[model samples]
Target: MSAAETAAETAAETATRRTPGLVPVGETLRSAERGPRQPAADPGTPPARMPWSFWRLLGSELGLTFRRPRNLLMLAALGVVPIVIGVALRVVAAEDGMGGIIEDVAGNSLMLTFVSFSFLVLLFMPVVVSVVAGDSIAGEAGAGTLRYLLAAPSGRTRLLAVKYVNAVVFAYAVTAAVALPALATGLVLFPAGDVTLLSGTTISMGDGLLRIVIAVGYVGAGMAALAAVALAMSTFTEVSIGAIAATIVLIIVCQVLRAIPELGSITPYLLPTRFTNFDAVLRSPIDTAAMGEGLLAFGAYILLFGSIAWARFSGKDITS
Candidate 1:
């Protein structure tokens, strides 16, 4: 062939190699059409972090817990019992002169609040706390929503923490449910004046109110510790009622042991024993040593049960 014809053939081959959709002599048509592929990500690169906030998850949990009709009814019951107690005491004072503890409550609204706390903290408040805390995990698992919650960006550890915190919030709500209504009823039905301590030392009304606040906080801490126990039990079963019942049964057994004079050695260690330690707040100088011991026991129970909950929840397979 002539030199110009040879050159023209070479130019045509080069154009074919560079053209889109046309495979080169050694390459596949798919490779030519697709072009160069993207490089794989580095093995050391961290994952794209989730933007979901912890507070939002906590808020959602709190809303669900408090909005349930059953929980609301429990709160209503807690609020009403104090009113009933106040009214009953008033009636008894009118019919037959109340003496001793009854007379104190009948005369002083603050005493009525203390008496209500004494009655409710043992069984009623624990029942409410157990109901809320026990249902935190088991209810979600039973409903088959727990898997979806875990599938979200929220980690198991964070979710467990949020559940416990939600329970603690409900525990405080329980305290207020008993406290506020009792205070209102006491003020309405009974006279407000200086509080006579169990030690018979009279403190000003302002001091009495402060002691009530302290009592509320102390009782709340005790309930929160119980909540940790219920939450741990919740992780072990998908049946919420089982967990709640078990917690209440445990409380009853402890109380029974506390009632036995022969079991005095173990009574101080029981959770129920600490529940009424709020009486320490009713003393003249305030029994800080006794209250401190009670608070310490509350903290120890929380740590022990909270660890159990974390261990069980973090490793468990989410079938539900």
Candidate 2:
């Protein structure tokens, strides 16, 4: 090569040298200059995020949900559980007569509350809520579908909201499943008319129904809090099983505490035990102080865990 040509070539080579941690722009330009022009990002394309629509996200989630066996099993349980339990109790208790059941409920809010906490709000419903919430976002990340969802126009906040709603809805459904059967059976078999309450009172069916609704509502709130806890755990784990298992362990630990003698005293101080007492509504005069305390404790749990989970989720490099 001629000296003049060599000097020019050396200058071009020096211009194309790469800088650390950055693309070699000059070299890239040289190569691309000989190639076809690239197309710009399409404006028509949806935003590379979860579409903020509530039901829209739910649609995507439902599709993802139906494809999985775990969610389906949970749904099935939500539907059939109440019917079965109600039927069985109806049959067995029929031999003894509804009179005894009504007597038990009449003037006995503590029994009702104990039954409520023991069965629905305390553990079972919380587990279901946590499973759905914990699995909603984390399961996607675990299964490598989170990127696709995040790209679908839904933002992290919207995604979390949808999951929370789904968890609440499902939790309500599950509680009704467990409760309605018992309630309906109790109503049909036992005379659910004006009944005496623990507080030396009598209330008509309407009043009792109102109390039931309120108690169920608290159950829903407790479930929501537990769901938040599970979701927090989920952010830390890709494996849905780990999230669900962790939630179950948290519940089991509470139940074990409730069973121990002196520890059982402290157990009532625990939110789980507090959540278990729905029968308090049936008492002549409902004692809601403990229930109130439980709800507040659960609320605190929801705020703390939910904030952490949201921070982690929103701050994470979600492309993976």
Candidate 3:
């Protein structure tokens, strides 16, 4: 062959070698036509972090909780108790038939408020809290929303904390719902003045109002412990009703055990044991010792169940 022909053949061979052998040039062009493909995500790689806003979660939860018809009805029902009690006392004072029930509604309306609070804290507060805290987790799971929520960038622990905090806030809100109405009704229907203490001493009206505020706060704190436990129960089940029922049942069991004379030794440790210790605030000199113990117990329970909720939620399988 001539030198020019040899060089031309060598150039053709090099060009052929440079091009793909199996895939045609047309196929390569088509692949290029398709834009760059993303690499598959590494299974072991952590997801991109999302900025979690505590206030946003809290606002959303609170908005959802209060907007529900049933929850609204429950809160309204709580507000009604004081109205009924106040009205009943107003009538009873005129008749003078019920002596043991309320000694002096006509003289000191503050007593009526205290009585209403006592009745509220016993059952109403717990029931109200159960509705919120009990449904916090189980409702999400049962509604098939928990999986999506967990899939969000927010960590499970942070989500649980938000739920727990929202439940506690609801507890306080419900307590205030009861107290404010009672105060308003008492001031309107009955006369408000100095309050007579159970210890046979009297406190000025301003001092009395302060004590009432403290009492309401104490009641809210006591219910917060129940709310925490209810949240833990919520984590264990997907049925909101089941969690609520279980929490109420637990309250009943504790109350029954507390009332049993035989179990007096252990009853002191029960949840409902010092629930009424808020009354100690009404004493001429406040009974901080009793209130302190009650608050401490509530704090301890909050820590115990809150930890359980975090552990369960963090490791939970998102099947739903």
- Write model 1 residue lDDT over 62-93, tens digit each, in one string: 89888899999999999999999999988888
- lDDT, candidate 2, 1-320, per-residue tens: 99999999999999777454332323333332333345666888764342446787677666665566776676566545544544454466546446654345433322243243444555667777777877876787777876655654456666777776676666676666656655654555444466566565777757876887887787777777788888888888778888888988988888888888977557655657766555567565676776777788878888898898888776665533
RMSD score of candidate 2 (Å): 8.4
Whichever of 1 and 3 has more TM-score, that candidate is 1
Ten-residue region with minimum lDDT total, candidate 1: 21-30
Per-model TM values vs. the true structure: 0.84, 0.71, 0.82
Candidates' RMSD to native = 13.8, 8.4, 13.1
TM-score of 2: 0.71
Provide the global lDDT of candidate 1 against the true structure.
0.88
TM-score pick, better of 2 and 3: 3
After superposing all C-alphas onto the true structure, candidate 3 shows an RMSD in angstroms of: 13.1
Best lDDT among the predictions, by candidate number: 1
Clashing pairs in 3: none
